[model samples]
Target: MIIIDAGHGGVDPGANGHGVTEKDWTLEVSLHQYHFLRKLGIQCKVTRDRDVLLTPERRAALVKQSGAKVCISNHYNAGGGSGAEVIQSIYSKSKLAKQAADALMAAGMPVRRVFSRKGTAGDYYYMHRLTGSVETIIVEYGFLDSAIDMKKLSIRSFRLQLAEEAALAAVKYSRGVENSLYVVQSGAYYAKDKAEKLCEELKQKGYEAFVRRMN
Candidate 1:
């Protein structure tokens, strides 16, 4: 099983810029990843599903309790950086982090780096140090303070795409499958009419298309 931790919530708003709040954006991405993983037949759990506060200690405890082998703590960066980054636990290798960085890069998000930080005690982040045996990864989707990042992250479609890609990376890492099969999806829409319209357009362009409802 994999655990998805949406960083910051409630009173802790995290980073905020360009009309986007870190807590809300992280939750949205985490929820999308959770559902996408489930659809792929992968067991998954999320730390918080709504606008609620969860301390670092509490979030780490939940990840350990879940017995999930992998925990993804999602956050939007702030500190003037313009690219995505994946921080792996110092104890873990860079495999998963590299995969995540690659996915973000493929989606046109610049990747700052895939590396681990260390504190005087041990792992730099609480999510890694306190999460017991779970392999915890801190993913900074992009810097919320940067206009370049917000330009893409502000779009619902782009955020959903990132969620799916992150989920896929987790699935690949946990399953140890180098050649996993992936489905090509054009888009995900909330409105049935919008989806059907896309389907019709695809069909008209000499492609086989259908609108499948998501439960």
Candidate 2:
């Protein structure tokens, strides 16, 4: 089973920018992903389904108790960065993190990076360090402080798409299907010229890239 965590709620509103709170956004995406997984017959659980508070310790305890293999902690970025990011434990491999990043990229979100951070003890985040053996992934969907990100995050459909794509990635990884084939697209563009421009850039970097029209 997978555990979905909506980061920061109740008293902790998390980052606030452009009139949106990080807690609400995280919860929205988590709820969407929870239902999507359920509909697909995938066993999953959410940390919080409403605007209630969950201490970091409490959240970690729930994840450990659930005996879940994977825990996806969803949070929105802030402090002025563009694109999405996936953070994994320093002890784990980047396979799952890469999958999550790729899913966000496919959903028209630029991926900043997929990497691990270390604390003095173990993993930098409590979700990773305190969650026992569960592979916890912290997904920063987009930066609320970034105009580029806000343009997309402001759209409800776009936010839902991010949640759905992330859920699909979690399902694939948690099921032990790590070798699934994936299309590596840099980003989606409205203008054909812009798409071609990015395609050329990738090709220059020794990547065999092409621009494909999405119907």
Report the number of the highest-lDDT candidate. Answer: 2
Q: What is the lDDT of candidate 1?
A: 0.87
RMSD of 2: 10.6
Candidate 2 accuracy as lDDT? 0.89
Off by over 4 Å in 2: 178-215
* Candidate 1 lDDT over residue span 55-131, tens digit each: 88888899999989898889999978888989999989788888888888888888998889899989989988999
Error of 2 at 197 (Å): 46
Predicted structure 2, TM vs. truth: 0.82
Against the true structure, what is each candidate's TM-score? 0.85, 0.82
Misplaced by over 4 Å in model 1 are 184-215
Please report how far candidate 2 places residue 134 from its true position, in Å.
0.9
What are the Cα lDDT values of the candidates? 0.87, 0.89
lDDT of 2 by residue, 126-201 (tens): 9999999888899999999899999989998889888878888887888777766455667999999999999889
Residue pairs of candidate 2 with colliding backbone atoms: none
